[model samples]
Target: MATAAKKESKPNAGFMKPVTPSKILAEVVGTEPMPRTEVTKKVWDYIKKHDLQDAANRRMINADAKLEAVFDGKKQVSMFEMTKLISNHLKA
Candidate 1:
């Protein structure tokens, strides 16, 4: 009897779709258009570089002057909420 061939999985296009960041978001992720995953990575990099994560609670993010604009004037936001807020600053 012949064995069945294995099927390869395709990458998710939605995650790879290019999105343009607003001016506020550009401050953290740069001005180039990139996939959402890359944007999230860049944001995390900036957060880490600036030591913006709350010392007491890692899940909380401390927004600086630059991030304040992106965060709609909020000084602090949760790690989970950060992604939701960031989405508002992105456009197709």
Candidate 2:
């Protein structure tokens, strides 16, 4: 007899929960409540639209005027650090 395939697990509820963004972050992601995943997506969209990724280092992001505030005056941040910095601008 053939064995059944394992079922896929659902995403974490906490991750899907909505959170409001701070004023600075709102400039980039808009003034609306969204899950952390969506917030990250919107930020990425803005980054791509503005071509903020460093050409020399693809893993680094160069903050623009709006992003500068969100990044806490940071001129550049790594992709990994971007997530941590963005979290500081989010609130449940």
Alpha-carbon TM-score of each model against the true structure: 0.89, 0.92
**What CA RMSD would you report for each candidate?**
2.8, 1.8
- The clash count of every prediction, one per candidate, is 0, 0
Query: Candidate 1: minimum summed lDDT over ten consecutive residues — where?
Result: 1-10
Estimate, for each residue in 1-92, the C-alpha lDDT of model 1 and write its tens digit. Answer: 43457567776899799999999999999999999999999999999999999999999999999998988999999999999999999999
Q: Supply the global lDDT for candidate 1.
A: 0.94
Question: Which predicted model would earn the best TM-score?
Answer: 2
lDDT string for model 2 (19-68, tens) is 99999999999988999999999999999999999999999999999999
Q: Which stretches of candidate 2 lie over 4 Å from their true place?
A: 1-4
User: Pairing residues by index, what is the TM-score of model 2?
Assistant: 0.92
Count steric clashes of candidate 1.
0
